[model samples]
Target: MLKDSFGRVATDLRVSLTDRCNLRCSYCMPPEGLQWLPKPELLTADEIMRLVTIGVERLGITEVRYTGGEPLLRRELVEIVQRTAALTPRPQVSLTTNGIGLERLAAPLAEAGLDRVNVSLDTLDRDVFIRLAHRDRLADVLSGLEAAHRAGLAPVKVNTVLMRGVNDHEAAALLRYGMKHGYQQRFIEQMPLDAQHGWKREDMVTADEILAMLGKEFDLTPADPRERGSAPAELFLVDGGPYRVGVIGSVTRPFCGACDRVRLTADGQIRNCLFAREESDLRTALRSGASDEELAERWKAAVRGKRPGHGIDDPTFLQPSRPMSAIGG
Candidate 1:
């Protein structure tokens, strides 16, 4: 396995297919959306495939996750998934989506050999959903979630970002709902990804608060984590059936110790951490006439430079050059 300086294996990769989106989340963007990536600068499906090939072969990557501003916004998403499915080892494929376009593409993506999905749904209440996402499409998102279920995306998980006053109340309810429906509800604390949005540290919802609420209702017995550098969310069954819940304390309680994943953006930059101040511009290398071996050499240098951890817990966070949208979630 490929181990970084943190001793975290680079087994999972989150690739951003595109930075364009259909909905604007309040935390992720300003009222005026950010400028879109230049058409000429974005990685083509073929170029993306070449990188994925390298990631699996060179980085010991076994899990390939497709993320985006909204992945389905890319016209070539199906092609990407298809090509990934055709990879030699057949890496476990997953997608993180906004759920707006999931209804149309879920089953097709599943048939395309996509393994699972992590849908971003911040609130169950319609008004709250609209308020958070700046769009009145809660019903549509819910419908898309149902469509994902119908599409055989078993163990479909919902990723909720907990804003201070926006959706914290929904946390416990989301847990109950997850338990009732066999879905894994993961609550992630907010973190500053870019300076454009002006995200603040005070706005975070800590995992302790989230667990306290669940501890009141159900016993959150810890399950043995499946693998090294798997996930921050300590797995637990919510007292009834096998319904599971995950909690990622990236901000208030950062889990940099076992951080496993690396991000490759739509524009082809390799970021070592979400709160990264620097990135290796793969797009520049690819477009500047670098050979495959040279490209791999550049990648090697970047991987060797991975930090032990972001160390966000120690009184600092990097002002990232890119936003969460550009970070591939």
Candidate 2:
């Protein structure tokens, strides 16, 4: 196991295949998106597989998650999942997507060996969805969730970002909808990953607020925190309901101490933390004919230098140079 200076073992690797996305969420990016990485600058499917192999075999990464501006946007996604699943001690594979293109790709991805899927659905109302995502594709997202469920992606999770006055009112409804469809619902507190850097604590909804809202609708019992493993979400069971809901309090309640994640940006930068001001460029080394062992060493060095936490509450904390989409949320 690769243990960082803080004694946190690196076990989860999030590979961002591309910095391109189909939707432009107001909080994530501008309505007219920012300049994207040129196609030539992005990592190829083969290169991603090689990195995954090194992370799995050499670095002992046990879980591999494909993230992106939207992961499904990658044409070679299924192939990537297939190759990841074929590893010796095959790491559990999953994806985090916007659900826009998932209707067509969900089944194919499951067939290709993806173990699970997490769809980002902030609201069920068509107008609200459109206003938030800058797209009128609520029906498509609904279909995608259903497709993922039909494809045997059990406990398909829904990631809902709660913006104070925005869609925070939909908390109970979203949880109920997920419960009805057998999706594990996770309410995420909005973070400072917005491209606009307009995140305000006053406008952000918190995990405590979400739980208080849910309390009015259903009974909730705190679950064993140990079951959370390396997941960022804090788990809780809906009192009498069949499923549970989780809250990722990245801002108000930071989980940085237990973070075991290392991200590979689409442009090939290795980020030790999402909010880290600096990144190590692995693309340059890779193109220079660096061996797999050398690449692994770089990865290890990056993790070894992982900071103790993402200082969201610190007065001097600065938003990252890149947005969530570019950094692979």
Candidate 3:
């Protein structure tokens, strides 16, 4: 098991397929975009599978989420999911994507054994979408969401980042839309992960603010806390019934104590924490003919050094050098 000194065992692995994204979301990157990782630097499909196999079989990884600047842009995504699903004691496989091309790939991805998907959609209005994403593909994203639903991706999650003076006013409407479409709406507090390093604490919409906005339109009671487990989102029963919404207060609530996730960069570096400044180089070890056991030990060592928390509230807090795009969501 990948146990850290803090007694947190990592069972969820987030792997970055690429650092290249189609949409230039204002929160994520500049319109010109940062330089993407070179093709040779990216782990091949076989390499990703090998690392995942080691993680699942040796390191107790029960869930694997493929992330990227936009994972839908990966050419081998379907094959990767299919192979991951074939593993012995198969781990749950999912993807975090921008939903750009999902309209065409949803059925194929479902058939390829993708268990679920989390699509990043900040606004329902096309003008706002363009302003946020710098793309005029709102219709495509909506179509992708519908396609995923039709393809049987149950509980299709919609991740919304509430930026003050941006799309924050749409919180209620976004939740209402999710409820109507059967999508699980997750409102996330904007963190210090933008490429431009432009995230301001004052500009972020807090979890409390999000709840207040939603509460005006719907009755929200806390969902069973026990059911939350190691999940980042704190769920709430919408209108006191079957449907629920989630709030990921990463900066405010900080669930690091129960965090079970570790990340692998597109180039195969192990990130014990999202805000970690250092990384363990698994790619070098793998390329140098290190055995699986050696690789696993490297991963374990990395996790053992994880800090107790992200420490964003501390005066000494420093934003990670890599943005959310490079570090995989």
lDDT of 2 at 153: 80
In candidate 1, residue 183 scores what lDDT? Answer: 72
lDDT tens digits by residue: candidate 3, 86-160: 997899999998899999999999999999999999999899998988889999999999999999988799999
Give candidate 3 regions above 4 Å deviation.
none
The predicted structure with the larger TM-score, 2 or 3, is 3
Give candidates' CA RMSD values in order: 1.9, 1.0, 0.7
Ranking by lDDT: 3, 2, 1
How would you encode candidate 2's per-residue C-alpha lDDT over 179-271 as one tens digit per residue? 888899999888888899998888888889999999998999888888887789988889754577899988877888889898999989989
Q: Considering every candidate listed, which one attains the maximal TM-score?
A: 3
Query: Which pairs of residues have clashing backbones in candidate 2?
Result: none
Model 2 weakest lDDT span, ten residues long? 235-244
Pairs that clash in candidate 3: none
| Each model's total of backbone clashes | 0, 0, 0
- Angstrom error at residue 159, model 3: 0.5
Ranking by TM-score: 3, 2, 1
Model 3's alpha-carbon lDDT is 0.93
